[model samples]
Target: MKTIAGFITACSIACSALAPQASHADTLTIALDYDPADLYGTLSTNNPMFAMLESLYLDDPRTGQVEPYLALSHEMASPTEVMVTLREGVTFSNGEPMDAEAVVHSVTVFSNPEIVPAYGIYAPMIDSAEVIDDTTVKIVLSEPNPIVDLLLAQIIVVPPDYWEEVGGTEGFGQAPVGTGPFVLTDWVKDDRIVMDTNPDYWGDLPENIDEVVWRTVPEASSRAAGLRTGEYDLAMNLPAIDVDAINAEDGLTVYEGDVARIFSLVLSSLDIHETPVQDRLVRQAINYAIDKQTIIDALYFGKARLLNGQVVLPGQPGYDPEMTDYPFDPEKARELLAEAGYPDGIDVEFKCASNRYAQGLETCEAIAAMLGDVGINASLTLLESGEFIGQYVRRELAPIGLIGLGVPNDPSFGIGVYRSDWRYSYYQNPEMDALIDASRSETDPEARAEIIRQASQLLFDDAVIAYLFGAQSFFGHSDDLEGFATNVAQRFFVHTLSLAE
Candidate 1:
C-alpha cells in the first residue's frame, strides 16, 4: 500500500526520465464526464472538487487505510472524542492560515444539515468541533463512532476568513480557495474549469504543469477522439468497448484499476414510490433475474469483480466470504414474482445516468433486458450526470436506480444506506437499524466486525438491492502522461500528474 508520498518517491527513483521537467508541456487538458455544480467539496459527494481542494486525510488505495494529508496527526482521545493536529505553515491559496479554526469551521459547515442537506444520508455524528490551539482541534462526537477517523477524512478545509468574506458557501464556490497544489482560476458552467498551480503550496509543487483544464465532454466517443487528436491529454470514464482500440493506437494508453464502488440497482422500499419493489419477494426476484457476470463480461470486459448480496467488497472488513451471489435463475425469479402477487408481470421505472460511470448506461440497459426475461417490464430512464446525481442525493429517483455506491474501509460506511435515519434510504428495518447502531459504538474490533457481518447478512436476506459488480475504472491518456494514479474511491491525485518530456 503506497501513499502519495511513497508514489512520488518511487517515481523519482525508478522513473526519473518521466519526472517533471521544465521542458515538458505547461498545460494539461483533460476531459471529464460532467461539470461540477459547485466547487464547495462538502456540498456534494460525487464531484471533481478534489482536483483543487485538499482533505485532511486520504485513503490509501491498496490498504484502505487513512493517510494524513493536510493533517499532521489524528488521535482518538476517547471513544467519543477525537483530537486532530493540523500541519503548520500551510496556507490557503488566499493567504489565510489553514489552522484549527479553519478546520473547525469546515467541520461545522459540513455536518450542518441546513447547509448540506444531503449530509442527512450520513447523519451528523460530530457533536461539535472546538479549537484547542492554533494547530490542534478537539472534536466531540454525538456518540461513540468506530469509524470517526474515516468520516473526518471527508472534510475539505477552507479559508475561514475568505469563506465568511464571500458570504458563505454559494459565494465561496464561485471562486474557491484551497490549500491544494492547484487553485481555481476560471469556471465556465457546462463547459470547462481552469486551475493554475498554486506557487505558494505547502507541499511539493507541480513541477512541469502550470495549469489544468477540465473540459466537459460527456460522450465517450468524443473524449476518446479528443485524446487521439492530442486535444485532451487525458480522458476519464472511457467505455470498455474502446479500450482495445485506444491501446492499439500509437501514443495512447489505457490505465485500468479496481475501484471501491459497488454498482447496484437501489430498490425503493418506501411507500411513497408505490412500486412492486416495495415487496421483499419482488426485490429478491429482481436480484435473481439478472445475470451479473454476463453483464460484467459484456460491459466491463470481465474486468469487474462480481459482488455478493451486499455492498461490502472482499477485502474490506466484515465482508463475509461464505455469502454467495444470487444465481441467474430466471425460473426462480418468475416464481418469486408470482408469489409476490404479480402473477403475470410487473412494471418498474429504471433510472440511470448515461455517463456517470464507465459503460454505466449500457450496463443498465443490459440489466433491464435481463429483467424483462423474467416478466419484469422495466422502463429505462436515462439522465445526464448532474441531474441523475441531483435526484439521487435528494432521494427523488424512481423505484429502481442504477448507481455506484462508493465504499470506504469501514463496513459501516457501505451499510449506512440501510439505516432508517438516512434521508436517502428507501428501506427501513428496525432490526437492521439496531445492528448498525450496535456496530457504531462497539469499541472492540471483534464485536464491531461481528455486528457489521450480521447487518450485512440482514440486508442480503431482505434483498435490499440488486447487487451488480465492483466498478473497474479505465482512464485513457497519452502515453507521455506520468504520475497519474487513482485511489479505490476513484479519486485521482491530480497534483502528482506530470507530462514526460
Candidate 2:
C-alpha cells in the first residue's frame, strides 16, 4: 500500500524552516523535459526545472496565507489594493538592488508589457503597477483580484539592469539573468542543460552538490532505459507501464504520487456538449466509457486515485467532501452514445502531450479505448511539453486534447485555473465566476467555506470537464535518502536531504 502514514507527519513541518541537512556527498543529475534558457521570457514555463538559477520576486510555495518569496511582507490596504515591502539587502544575480520600482518594471514586462513567459501573449492584466518607494510597491487592482501576489511569483522577475539591456520588450530574450538559487551555465536544446549553484544564493544551501545536469528523454522507453543504465539518478516523465520493472531494478526507486492537477474531457458548452463533432451525450458517455479504475490499476499500478468530484484533493482548506466520483460503467457509456445520436460508432481525435505528467499518454490511450466502447472513435495526437503548453496550459482549443495542471497547493490558486482569464474555450461560467468572486471576498471562514462549496457544486453539476483523479504522491530515493516532503509540491529545500551512509 506504499504506507502513507508519513504524509500525516509531513504536515507538521514548520513551513519556513529548512529540512534537517543531509550528506551532500555527490553531484546530482536531474532529467527534465528540455533545457531551460537564460532569458526569463525565452524559457519554457515549467522548463527551469532548475528553479535554483532563476528566481522570482515572490516564492509561491511557502506563503499561501499571505505572501512569501522576495517580498518581506504584504498588506491589503483595501480589498482591491495591496502594499508590498521588498526584503532589504536582496540583489539580483547581476548584483542590482531589489527595489520596488524595479519590481514594478519587471512585472511590467512579465505581464507581457515586455519580456513575458515564452510564447507569452495576451495584452497583460492589471490596471497598473505603481512604485511607491525604494523597497515598497503598491499594486492597484482593476477589480478585486485577491490572488495578485501569487500571480506575481509565477511571473518570474528579471533585474531592471539586465532587462533594459534586452532592449525593452522587443529583444528581451537575447540574454537572461535571474535571482534564483542556481545559475544557468549552458543550454544545448534537446541535448542537455547544465546549471551550477548560485554562490550568492539568498536562502540556505544544499549540503555539497555543486551542480545539476538535466537532460531530455522524449520517448518513455528511452527515459526508462536511461534510468536503468544509471544515465539519470532522478528523472521526470516516467510512464505508468514501466513502474514494476523500475521497482525490481537494483539501486533504483520509483517515487509515486497524485499530482494536484485534474484531467477532464471538456464538453464544449457552446452547444451544451451537443455541438457538431461533440455532444453532451458524448461527454456523458465518455464519463461512463472511461475505465478510470483500470488506468489507475493496470497502467498506474494503483499509484493513483479514481476521482469524480470537480475538486480532487480534500486536505486543502476549502474542499468539499460530499461530492462523489463518477462511477465506471461501460454499458452506461454505450447507452449514452446511442442517445447522443451515435449508436454504431463515431470517430474523433484527442490530443495529448507525449511526455509531461507521468502516464500522460497511457491515460489518453485508456480514454481512447473507453471511447471506442461508447461508439466514439478516437485517435491521439501527442506533442512535447513546450508544444503542449503552447496549446493546452494556455488553454488553446484546437481538437480535444489532454492537459496536466500543476494545481497549486493552495485552494484559491488551485481554483484560479478555472477563472475566466484561464478558462480557454471549453470554460465559461457567469454564475461560477460570481461564486468565485464571493469566495475570494468573504473573509469569514464559515462564509468562505459556503462560497467554496457552492463553487465546487457549480463545477460538479456543470461537469465542465470529466473529473479524473488525484495523484497518489510519492518520492523514491536510495535507502539512505531521507527528509524529502512526499506531498505534491515536491520542493528542493536541499538543506533537508541527507545520505544515511
Candidate 3:
C-alpha cells in the first residue's frame, strides 16, 4: 500500500497535461460542495478554512501518524504534562508574532467551556496551558492521555491581539487570521471566498500556487460541467455517479483517495420532540428497514464500505470485529415496531443535505421508500449544504438526521463522543463512559484497544444511531492541475497544488 504522500506524488506525475506549457494564470479557482460556516475555529470541517489555518501537528492520511508542522518538537515531561518548542519567527497574517502566548490562547479558546462548546468534548484531557518561555509552552492535563499530541493537532493557533481587537469569536468568524500558506483576502457568504499566498510563511517554500478562489457550486453535475468548460480548475466532492464520465472526458482527470468520513442517520437519543425514535426498538427497526448495502451498490458504485455501528472502521485500532451490523429485513423491522407499540406505524422526519455527500439526496429518498415499506411514514426534508451544517451544529435538526462524520486521525479522539457532554450526542451510558475514560489514559496499546472494543460493543448493542457506510471521495480537476490530494480528514491541502505544464 502506498503512503498518502506517495499516492499524491504518483498522481501528480501520471495526470495528463492539457497544454505544453504550465498554466501561467495567477489565479486558481476551485468549486466546493458547501459554504464554510465559521472560520474562527477548527470545529468546522470545511476545506477552505484549512487553507488559511495552521495546526501544531499534521496527520498522515494513509497512516495515522503525527508529523511535526508548526511545532519543531514536543517532549513529554510527565504522563500528564507536555512541553513543546515552537518554530521561531512565525507570524500570523495580522502581523502578530506566533509565540507561546498565541498557542496558549488558541488552545484555551478552543477548550473553553463557554465558547465553541463542542471542542470541549475533543480536548477534555487538557487541564491548563502556560507559557514557559518566548518560544515554548507547557500543557497540564487533568489525566494522562495517550493521544494528547494527536488531539492537539486539531486545535489551530490564532493571534490573541487581533482576536480581541475585532470582537472575539463573532468577528473572527467573519474575517479570520492565521499562520498558513494562504491568507483570506475576500469572503462573500454562500457564494465564494478568495485567498492569496503569504510571502512571509516560515515553512517550506516553492509553494507554486499564487491565488485560490473557492466558489460554491452545490450540484455535482454543475461542478463537473464547470471543470469541463474551464470555469473551474478543480471541483471537489463529485458525485460517484459521474466519476467514470468525468475521467473519460478529455483534458480532465480524477483523483481518488481514502477518507474516514461515514454517512449515517443520527438518531435523537432523547425525546427532543414528540417522535418515535426515542424508543430503542424503533431505532433498531429503522436501521433494519434500510438496506445499507443496496444503497452502496446502486448509488456509490462500490466506492464505500459498510460501517458496522462504530465510528472508526476496520483496519483501524480498537475496531470490534464481533459487533454486527443490523441485517436488512423489512419483516423484522415491522415486527420490532409493533413490539414497541407502533403497530399501525410511526411518523418521523428524515433530514439530509443535498450537496454534502455523494448522492446524499438520493440516498435519503431511498431510505424513505424503505421506511414506507415497513409502515413507517418518513418525511424527507432536504436542505442545502450550508443550511444543513448550521442546523446540525446547533442541534436543531429533526428527530432523525442523515449526517457524515468521522475520526480520520485517531480512534482515541473518536471515542470521545461517548462523553455525556458531547455536543452532538444525546445519549449517555455510565459503563461506556467508564470504558472510554479508562482507554484515554491506558499506556498499553493492546489494553487500550480492548477497552475501546468493549465501549464500541456497548454502543453497537444500544443502536442509538443508524450506522451506515464509509464513502470514498472522488476529486475531479483539470488535467493541468498538479499536487492536489485530500487527507483522511477531507481537508484540501491547497499549498501542495499548482498548475503545471
Candidate 4:
C-alpha cells in the first residue's frame, strides 16, 4: 500500500509540469477544480455561480451573522410570516428593477419543487410571497422557522421580467441576470467562465479588477503550478503538501481559514439496503476504528479541527462542548465486528469523490487502510465530481460514502440531511425526526437551541456517521491580491478584492 508521504511526493512531482501563460493585468484569473453545472443559485447551496448573483441577505465577515444585502431591512411580522423591505434603485445587470415584485418572483420560483430540484425539499417551508408595495414584500412560512433570516440568505435574487422573457431557469442560466457586482460575459463548457464588472451595480464597484475568469483545473498540483507561474491569480483547494513550497516563492502566499463545512463518512443504514453498516455495533465500530487527529495532522498539517458531532460545529447553534469524539480503538472495533457476526472480517465498498474536497482521495486511502486494521476490508471506489454528485443526490451510491455538508450560520441548515424524508438521507430514526421537526418552529432562542442539541446528541449516540473534521480551505494567491476575503460559509467577497498597484 502507498503511504501518505508517497502521495504528497507524487503530487509535488506532477506540479512541476505546468507551463506558464501570459498574465492579464486587469483580469483576476482563478483556478477552480470543476465546472459549474448551472448559474442558477437556487438549484444549489454552494457553487461558483454565486459570484454573478446576489442574495437578499449575506453573512457578515467580521461576525458570522446574517445581515441584509439587497434587502434593506427585514422583521418577523408574525410567528409564520416575515416582511422584507428592498433597497430602492437596485437593478439587475439586464436593466430590470430588483424591487419587491422581483423578490416575490424569486421566492416563488425557489419554492417550486419542479423548478429547483436540488433544494426542492426546503421549498415547503416557504408557503408563499406577496408584494405589499413597490419596496416591501411579505413571505409566509408553512411553520414558524427560527432561522428565517439565514434561510432567506440563500435565496439569490433575480429579475422576474427577464426570467419570463428568457423562458425560465434553463434559458436564464445560459445568460444569467443578477444584481451582483460581476456580469457573466462568456463561458466555455468545462474550460473557463469569464465575467466583467457590472457597471450598473447598485453596490460599490470592484477596485482595479476589470474582468474575472474561472478556469477548470482538476489537478491540485496544476492549480498550484498555475499560481506560481502567474498563469492564475488565485487557486482554490490547493493541497496542504504544496503550501510550504508555494509560500517559499517570492510573489505567492497561501491563506488558510476554517470553514463551516464538515466532512464525514455517511453510512447507508436504511432498511432498504442490506449491509453490515446497518447494525448499530458495526457503525460504532467503524467510528472507533480510525484516528481523526492523525489524519488531520498528516494530511491537513493540523489545519483542520476534529468534529464532535455530525453536523454542528463549535460557535454555531447547538454546539455541545461536553460531547466527546470517538477515540481510536481498533481492538474495540474488532470485538464489535466479531460480536456482530463478522468474526474473521467484513468487506465493504467505500465510495468517494476524487477531487471534491481538499486531499479527499488521499484521506479516503488513509481511512481505508485504517479500516483494514480492524479486519474491515474497504474497497475504494473513486468517482469524479459530476458522477459523484449525480449518484449522491439520487441516493444511488449506497452502503458507505464520504461526503461533506455545510452548516453555514445555523445548525438547522446542516441537520436537515439526517431527516428521513430528506432527499439525500441514508439513515432513519423516529426520535431524530421529532427533534429536528421541533426545532423548526421553535420561537425562543434558548428553547430552539436545546432542541437542536438534543437532535445532535441523538445523531452522535446513534453513530449515524463516522464524524470526521471541520474543513479548512487553503487558497494559493499572488501577494499583490489585496482585500481578498471569504466568509465562514466559504463565499468570496469578489467586490472587495483588488490588485496592488
Report how far off residue 308 is in candidate 3 (Å). 2.6
lDDT per residue (tens digit) for residues 1-501 in model 3: 333343223222311110022332477899988777766543455778777778888774434477777898889999888898899999986679999999999889877766753345657778889999989999888888777667677778889987776556755665677888877766676788877777777765324467788898888899989998999999988888889998999989888868577777877776565688888899899989999999999999988988777876777679877677899999999999999999999988888997788788999998899989999899988888767877776666668889887555667656676566666665667787788788878878889888888878777778768888888888899877877776666666676677764
- For model 2, the local distance difference test gives 0.58
Best by lDDT: 4
Which 10 consecutive residues of model 4 have the lowest summed lDDT?
Answer: 11-20
User: Candidate 3, TM-score vs. the true structure?
Assistant: 0.91
Candidate 1 per-residue lDDT over residues 1-501, each given as its tens digit: 333343333322322221122332488899987777677743355345666678788765544477888898888898778899899999887788999999999888877776752333344677889999999999888888777667767777888877776567765565667888877656677788777777788888755788788899988889988999999999998888888999999999998867577888889887788888999999999999999989888778878888877677786667888888889999999999999999899988999997777788888889999999999999999888778887876677769999887655667768877787675577888998888778777878888878888998888888988888887777899987887777766677777777876
- Assess the local accuracy of residue 256 in candidate 2 as a C-alpha lDDT between 0 and 100: 66
- Better lDDT candidate (1, 3): 1
Residue 421: error of model 2 in Å?
4.0
User: Which regions in candidate 3 have their CA more than 4 angstroms from the true location?
Assistant: 1-24, 61-64, 117-120, 205-207
Local accuracy of candidate 2 as per-residue lDDT tens digits, 1-501? 112232122322211111222323365566664433333434344534335423333332333332477777777788767787777776665677777767887667656533355422221335567888888888765566545555555545567765565454333342345566655555566766555666666776555556556676666677677777767666665666777777887787877644665666655554333443446566666666777777777877776675547563667656777777667888887787777677796777677777666677778888887777667777778877667666654455434666555554556645544656443446677787777666555557777777777777777666556777666533334433454443344444443344444
* Residue 239 error, candidate 4, Å: 1.3
Shift of residue 295 alpha carbon in model 4, Å:
0.9
Q: TM-score of each candidate?
A: 0.90, 0.79, 0.91, 0.90
lDDT of each: 0.78, 0.58, 0.77, 0.80
Candidate 3 clash pair list: 22-501
User: For residue 280, what is the lDDT in candidate 2?
Assistant: 59
- Model 1 bad stretches (over 4 Å): 1-25, 60-65, 117-123
